[model samples]
Target chain A: MDNIAGTKSSLTWAVHISVAALVFLWLFPTLGLFVSSFRTADQIATGGWWKSMFPSQQNLTLRASPASEQKLEGSLYVIEGELFEEGIEVEISRWGASSQNISTYAAGEVGEFRSGETVTVQANGSYRIESETEISGSRGKRIFVTAITPPEFTFENYQNVLFDESNREGMAKAFFNTLTVTIPATVLPILIAAFAAYALAWMDFPGRSLLIAAVVALLVVPLQLALIPLLSLHNDITTFLNGLLGLEGANELKGKGYVGVWFAHIGFGLPLAIYLLRNYMVGLPRDIIENARVDGATDFQIFVKIILPLSFPALASFAIFQFLWTWNDLLVSLVFLIDSTGETTVMTKQIVELLGTRGGNWEILATSAFVSIAVPLLVFFAMQRYLVRGLLAGSVK
Target chain B: MHPAFLGLFTILVGVSVCVGYYYFSNQLLDKVLFPAKGPNAGRNINRREMIRPWLFLMPAIFALGLYLAYPVVKTLLLSLSERLPGGASQFVGFDNYTKLFADEKFWEALQNNMLWLLVVPAACTAFGLLIAQLTDRISWGSIAKSLIFMPMAISFVGAAVIWKLVYDARPIDQDQIGVLNALYLLFGGQEPQTWLTIPLANSFFLMLVLIWIQTGFAMVILSAALRGIPEETIEAAIVDGANPFQVFFKIKMPQIAGTIVVVWTTITIVVLKVFDIVFAMTNGQWQTQVLANYMYFQLFTAGDWGVGSASAMIIMLLVTPILVWNVYNARKEMR
Candidate 1:
């Protein structure tokens, strides 16, 4: 078969080439964000992220040594110092003393400034200025240089987004808020749905098939319909219960916080969880359950001891799905959790706010977005086996 | 209370309650309500079996009904009534629907959603099939497939930021920072065009983000289907002198047609509910409104619950056919 057609080799090459191309096309967007997150605001705005890997030529405004550092050398007052900070990888390609002609002279060349000072700037940003007369200015001379700096990346953006205490828009609280929303929202649904799935799968009841059909139908019900009605219902129930019990903070407890959001996620996530787990459970071997039954174990014991343990793959798959969905959810949190106090804002909402206020601030936007995405990406790649298995099971029935 | 501690406490409470309820309910049903050692033991066990399923199903049914089912009906009712202050409402049948029908933004959203429905699914499916077929025979196909599938992990807002950088534009006579505009400049374009400001084309640009994320899903499913196309059929076609293209379109594709429909419908559902991308990227500005964003704008910003519920009903209306189709398929499969 291999020898039948030499054209197969060329076809194989084409396959390899096309796959590589497609992979690059897919990875480019994510890679752009990943690369830009480490960059400074100046770097990100001056050039595209793809160009961040190379030495970037930039017009820099730097100050020379002030008059205090000027030494009397022979008859002239001279100032000698390096323009760039220590250990910075910068090559002064072109240098000038004025804004109009910033690249007036090449590296290692000397020119006369407007003050009649002869200046020489070397490629490594070392410069010497010799004045004909006494230099009396208190401020240092301004030197504009067009330099090719080595590709630079900084953690300052991440620091500002995550750890800056004074920054009102920091993602620290939102990160914790997202964690609070996600953990219970993820855990409760699996706990609740696993039981129902077992009943639908193993236990016999009337309308079992119909229940399965309903779960499948509920899978695509848009959450948009749930927003207004649920909000009103929640508010009314909270207020009535508060008045009934004569409690002070019942309204605060029930109004757009963690518990309400937890319930919202559990409810919204139940359909897919049940659907996935039931599909997986129905495929489990009947012999195990029958053996447990014959041994006089009750349905609860069988579910807890035998079915739950054996359904790990399915359970793990659904847990990952629910976790990612709950973590990434914005509309749900916006409607159900975030009150006027804004204390319950999640990372998605935080990023949206940043998109509005700091639209041009890629440093903040990129870092905040990366922070939000990093956790799910870790969960995704770490448990990709279960994730893919879940996708295959959930969709390709 | 600190949120972290509250989180830990809630997990404990939630798990314990769920586990405790199932354990206790089952025990009560067996040991108290239907004692197996009674004189009518056989009948008691039979009765217990009939009741056990409902006990197991109670929590799930309650949650789903409260969260999903009731909302569907409540939304329908709310669509017909206008909300008054202080937890009261007056029935105003057909008023909300009439107002919604008259609004131009709703029409724009509907039209744009139609466009999204058409483009996103088709592009995702086609690219998915192309990648699937190409990668099926390659040695490094799995790696390529995973790379493409990686976008599924990203949130739509994160993806918006990623693509906002790509669609970024700069004024003429300045160095372009966005890759799209940079390429445009490099390839002899006159001025830097704001890719997201252009009305009709901007919607397509946003659709590209979803298409990029979803094609991997389509590929994963379609690739599995392609592999399942029995080896005998492909070998037989090749031996009969059908070329590669003919073998694909004439033989292999027809077998995977059912899967193609499934992928298309799945992505179509996703496209119909597309909100976060449009919200984060443009917020439906410059004629880019979709139903979900428009509904959000109505409900929250404009404070019009009646019209908001109507738009939500429209979304539900769009989803009804798919819901029926999915249920029909499930029932058919069960039979």
Candidate 2:
């Protein structure tokens, strides 16, 4: 029985090992993204992120001097630069004008050139040109320099992605734009919803059931159905009412209209917001509101003095969800917030264009992506304690 | 028009939350907002009490009405029209609906959507279940959970970029540089494949990206549900000599049916309007058009407002029954 049990334990261990391997296979791609963000585009293009830790020796070509200037002094036309210093072994390999046939010679190998020139490269970053005469050309000579690059990492990509003025359309602006939309977008819905939720959850009203049903029904309606018709309606409304508000025509307000997008954000955010907030507000201890009501507290006073204070966890958690959802939104912002020209492009759109232009360049993408996600991450982490507790509150109760 | 909207708007006149932040010290709310552990509850119900909540709610309602409600009405109207060039259309009742039935691309899109609705949610749930089970066995369970959950945090647009690299194809003769093609060659395939060009194969390939992203979402929710299962029930099942698989299938799963439905429906709703991934990845090209992408092309790209609105209405109508079911479930969970 002991031997049989031991064999079963080993089998269980084997099963566990295979499962662990599957998990790693699943996770490596995103992990590669995080790792690749810190690497050069060239490096990422050449090999996997696993190889980045090791030092790599790469051969590079440098144009040092002109071929015609070679006087053939001492049976050699010497063109030299500070490419190699003492104690630094700079090596040269194959050389060609066409990048297609770049790898023709081995480092430290002698070659007889078609120009009647004999060339040999050295390991110590020096080469000997034992040519009968120098080749002729007005343009500088084509020389290949191979160097061993030490393991390197830089914050330059992150800085460029995040802080460069050219990147003003970057995370900084998007961060602020996100805040502009998110703060009001979140705060407004809760303010409205809290009152409605309070009414639905606590206070009595004639149309209360109808309103609750409406919001719940609204929750089922996906936002994608609203995108185009919404934009044209916005244009029409602005046109119809631009006369009333002393505002420019609908097309003129164009991409700069935060009014349209702010409305869009709030609309999409409402039903769920009201539902979530109501669920939370409804769950608050009834005794507190009842006691407050007995102490001359009207419905308004009860909401203010008792219910709102107790509903902190729910409010905070909802805010985090609203902020993250609105911040990461591409579709709503693209249709509503984006201008006729590309001027008002948000960070998410900027990152998207960067993907189109610099698709293979992981450094630019990863750095920008990290920037785009930084706020959401920070919001999630900061209010995370409230988040799960809030959204999940109504479920268990 | 809600009483909540009216009451708050009336009371908050002149005095506002934004204004209160600056001069709230002398006011009642400074004391009321922080009652007891705060200041004592100030004056109970006063003039500001009536309008305060609605004061806050008014901007939100106005915004919701203008952006959300108006478009819904407008789309309903546009769905009946024969759209002209200058945003004008002749009202054509139900002809758009007639065209909707006859269009092959519409049916193809509808079929593909059903395929997504079937394939993606089923695949996502399976992967989520697998990961949840395997990770539950691991020592560093949260680490595994976090790794899967990490994808959930990225915007759909960001995931598209990560996938573009994974699906990137080069000439078959040159080099199989894409990860999938490279794997195929490594497995001794004769020629590199254009994974995107193969219609059914590409659909499955695109589905993988959606599956990749959503598996994490499913796992987190399901993991939470799994955690909610009572330990004693499992112990009881084990004592009955039920196998581990039996314990999972019969014992643990039946307990969390509601949570499973919630996660599945939520992903279903998300999959219905999936635009960014399909748009960014394939731009809905080569038999890749889903409803949301097709709606976008019809409306914005082709400027066919009537058909677009009708399609939007159709998507909304399709999602409605599922949503009603979900709301019913939610109410059940609530009660």
Candidate 3:
């Protein structure tokens, strides 16, 4: 018992280290984005949020109240106001001639400027600028200032991303577009796949094996090969059908819309959907299917009654996979759906547009990114059990 | 002899039968299932068993041929020609292949794709194994798996957005707005490196996105494989005095080697087909392109269909051995 406890402790240590490493590996970049998104554009430029936790000095230049406004209380001109913001601490660093070279002053000492001038700024916003003659010009007096800022964060970036109507390519619209493309693409494949899978698995077949092999072969063919030809084929078929139906010159029917994309997806997706569904369907107990047949069931009846019901888990699993994949796909949509106007642009394209415009803004990117991912996250969580749950329910359950 | 004609004939017959059965199946199903239920359902019909197979095979057979077979032949033929503007293509045997071999961009794209195939699969497998192993023992195992699998749900396009923010670089004069540069500045770096613009490293950087997406897939499949390992075999090994590491390495790993290979190959095949991430993010610039993107560039943007087709065939040719192995393995597993 003692030995076992000791061994378990050591084993636990090994597991802990591995888990820690994996977590670090998985994290970091996104956390950086979350931290970055809150920062000012300048802050993100100069320092990381992690460093912002410490007090850091920054030079701020403000014009002193005009020389005319400098009150003469005694023999001197004294201006009094607060320096920096309230509750922020500052020791007056040396003042400067220009915003660029700001470290020329000592506390309680005057610095000479061009044209025989002098200025002094104290720990407070109090200051005095003296010249042999009155200072004049449209430009106001410039004072060098310093202040310590505490760590700050805001939802402002998210606000800009989500609420700005001018941003036509906002992630929200793109998210909807993605959903528009994804749900149909995902569901269509499963519908077709389930029907085809049932036919391939349970329905007797002569070239069944050959068809399966052909699909299996297709699983290898790269989708890139099909982009143009498939589009033209789609164009040809739609035109031919429309012509036959006397819906002449329906050119608008074929390019860059949900219809075109869904069909493209269905075309590209059919082979795999059938293949995966068939793999799962073939695993169904022969007895259950046989019993339904023996009970005088037609193929469609068995498919609807016993097979669809029995195949729920596989259907669910395949649905989860297909949904996630199609939801994430860009290439299929790009070739099949992209048009001159970009009316049907999806979330992926929208994000790329953002990358080009506000590419430097991590806050906007992260917020938009998180927004884009929300649905997929929901779908994955809702459907992940299908990946592992026993599909042979009661046949082997 | 041509599969296209074969497919066409099959489609015609199949469609006719499906339409014929639209009424006929009602008669058959009523007798068979309902004895008289709905318009589509009926009772008492005679059909031979021999006809059913052909009936089922028709749609599956013909659909596969036109979609898969004809396109494949057309693509191979494309490789042997030069795609002229206005869609006329002239014969130019091996020119595309030679161009691909000699072209720097082509070589770079191919190399990047190979890197993706190598790194994405192996890293995903490793990361997945770590997550699976860690989560398996913890009380919140399901939560961990679900969290890791979250990226699986997000489109690669979506995940790429998240990562792009991380890798985003601004001008050096501007504040480091991106997370990566911000961190780099924290430690004092001068150049605000556009991480994606960095040629060679960008491949690995891009690979991380694929890894992020694939880890969940790998984990999901492998976790299933892990659960499939019998407890009795494990306990027996433990009783025989195998340590936890030994049990894991010796017993568990060996049991799931087939699953590992299947998952690895599955991802590798998908990795070879990866175009979305590259196309969306970089548009094949700064050495971030892969074979699929190259094919897209040549065929669509460049309007060189023959070269595009040639590249497509090359990709298919590259994937053949892996696909064959996959079928063999899947067949073995089915048994």
Docking class of 2: acceptable
lDDT-superior candidate, 1 or 2:
1
How would you encode candidate 1's per-residue C-alpha lDDT over B1-335 as one tens digit per residue? Answer: 89989999999999999999998999999999999986999999999999999999999999999999999999999999998997589999999999999999999999999999999999999999999999887778888888898889899999999999899888887778789999998999999999999999999999999999899889988998898899888778878887778888999899999999889989989998899999999999999999999999999999999999999999999999989999999889888
Q: Clashing residue pairs in candidate 1, if any?
A: none
**DockQ for each candidate?**
0.75, 0.28, 0.29
Model 2: CA > 4 A from native = A1-23, A35-53, A56-179, A206-210, A245-256, A354-367, A381-397, B1-74, B83-90, B172-177, B333-335
Best by TM-score: 1
- Candidate 3 on B237-295: residue-level lDDT in tens? 87687777788899999998877887787788889888878876787898788898888
Instruction: Evaluate candidate 3 by giving its C-alpha RMSD to the native, one decimal.
Output: 7.2
lDDT of 2 by residue, A123-237 (tens): 5556555555556768754556545645556787777766788864366666556555555656666666666677678865455565565666677687866786677677777
Kindly list the per-residue Cα lDDT of model 1 for residues A5-91, writing each as its tens digit. 223644777788878989998998889889999999888887888888888788899999889999998998999999888998898
Error of 2 at A251 (Å): 11
lDDT of 2: 0.68
Task: Give the Cα error of residue A73 in candidate 2, in Å.
Answer: 12
Strongest candidate by DockQ: 1
